[model samples]
Target: MSPRNSLLLVLGMASALLAQGPDLPIDPANSFKVNLPGDGPLALVSADWGRSSATARGGAMLVDLHSTLVFKNSSPRPIRGVSLLVLAQEVTPGGKASVTVPSLDIQSGESFPIRVDLRLMRPLNAGSGALVQVGLDGVLFEDLTFYGPNRLNARREMLAWELSARRDRKAMLSTLLQAGPEGLRRQLLSVLARPADNLVMGMQVARALPPTNIDPGRVVEFAFLQFPDSPVELLSGEARMTGTEARAPRIEIQSKSKRPIRFVELGWLARDEQGREFMAGTLPADLSLPPGAHSTIRRENTLRFAKPVNGLTAYPSAVEYADGELWVPAYSSLKDPRLAAALPASGEERRLAQLYRRKGLEAVVQELRALR
Candidate 1:
């Protein structure tokens, strides 16, 4: 698959939430915000059951519900992620099941499709046809801020968890500051042991500092390759590498399109003079540049590296705009292995993947199966 397509696949696999429904499709009109504010509206555009099947598994009947869910952004700004509280609208007897949809980036007025695959065991005394009910519990923005009616109280629950996580983070930072290097590894492992529900903590750990903090004076320049049909131009920018952290203080872009540009993401690749290369990270640009206007993105987000290197030059691997448009490496560009390898993984991704790796898939399955 092409890199952009691969990115879409990775995003789907990485950011899904759990939920469920019935054999028949339900009208999305019934799905409403329970406690959300009137601002930043997100709509369930549609929901349909694509297929269903039943089979005998060890003496119980196993059922599978495959579905397609469509969501639209009705708000003014762009959205990077969504969280829903999906419940089994109706179930006969008592069957256990869960549903999931990808966390995604959605531009204003744009709609996207997410595949829902649910599995449950048939209840011994249950009748045919189960109904699934879903609600908009919360919405996550690109800046990590959250909003929604929160009918399921997920926001409140998450807030409680985050508060606890903050305490834990403060303690860990204290350990790093006082205990010094010898006692650090044990704390790192302990932090990694936390559950995925501690989302904020997981993100912090991914960007955790190395035992020895060193700020090298090495500087790297960013080269621009504009989108094939893009009206935006990358004028100038550079990033400084200190230890494993890369910081870009200023990135300038010029817009020539009639429509104002609202967002842009530049994929970073670290290539040393020796040709050794790997995926570095991404620079996300949220802007409001009108036609013929130029915007300078300040150094705010920090990109992390697996190891320190020298003589690096960064390039754009992917780019997205406000008008529900995207720019990624063309299929032919994949011929250059370096461009193909720079798809950066976020810290949260590294933490959670490590969680699954150490705790096993069954642990993850159990966590998602719970209705909390």
Candidate 2:
């Protein structure tokens, strides 16, 4: 953050009333408010609004939201994910925010927490009546179903994370069963100690067709990173690329499964000029491909970056069936030596690592077993 930017934390609540912290430097009254429905699959249990403040800088204002909310799975199904909408300033064009909690395994009648943390800027004259509004955006259940508004496309994102969570847990459990506690400990330690991948090379994406008759680079065919469990088989794929941009991605696929596919997201790993590879973004397409059928997915979206990229490898990242069931790349496939370095840790992996850090290895093991 720059020196001119300020951050204030919105922090407390229990049950039906909102709780405030002590010694706060008095922000604008009613600057932050949270609205949650009581009749949803997950009911609001409590909120610990930590401490929130608004700072005025001439005609602009900075608001910080950082808090944890507690909710219970009041419905009969397990909750896989949740998303909370954070309204920074209703008057601002892009002032909205969302907090999504994925890789959750909260069973019926169980309690879970969602943490919201973001720094937003708004006009000072926006209003004193709730400078920020927090509400429900979406929730995903264990049965591959969803509740709440589908505003943020949280359904697919959460489902993908949940699938990854399940994969990670099973993978670690397999390690524990085969090699015992020491081996499992080593595995967890390795992930916890692993440093984050250096993916700092930036990219600008435009969802429109690339400019015609321009310096669009040569055509590049994508190399496949095949997964045995993937529902779709990649026949061929290619994209137009320049030193600073990749555009007009087109891929042909065949459904190998009995169920029809409704959605598929392809992720590519690109190598920079320095030979360092990073996960470039995903290209999600919503379509229908029946069993033993072939289809082609195309997009005019263009991705531009400062550093040149080689679209080295492409893989199936997320796939959803017509029945609303989702499929993610298996953990075993992601553990390939080729991908182990480029791929980032899943949400559940991060949670387990944090659990080990805060509560010890035994706690993680116990949680994993309980979830199982």
How high is the lDDT of residue 164 in model 1?
30
- Candidate 2, 176: how far from true, in Å? 0.8
Question: Which segments of candidate 2 are over 4 A away from where they belong?
Answer: 1-32, 43-78, 88-92, 105-113, 119-132, 141-145, 199-204, 207-215, 357-359
Top candidate, metric lDDT = 2
Q: How do the predictions measure up, each by TM-score? A: 0.37, 0.76
Candidate 1 per-residue lDDT, tens place, 262-370, comes to: 6665655555445565555455666787888988877654565555545344444434456534444443443345453443323333343454568764443343334
Model 1: how far residue 345 lies from native, Å: 13
At residue 175, give the lDDT of candidate 2.
80
- Write down the RMSD of all candidates, one decimal each: 23.2, 8.4
Instruction: Name the candidate that leads on TM-score.
Output: 2
Question: At residue 168, what lDDT does model 1 achieve?
Answer: 36
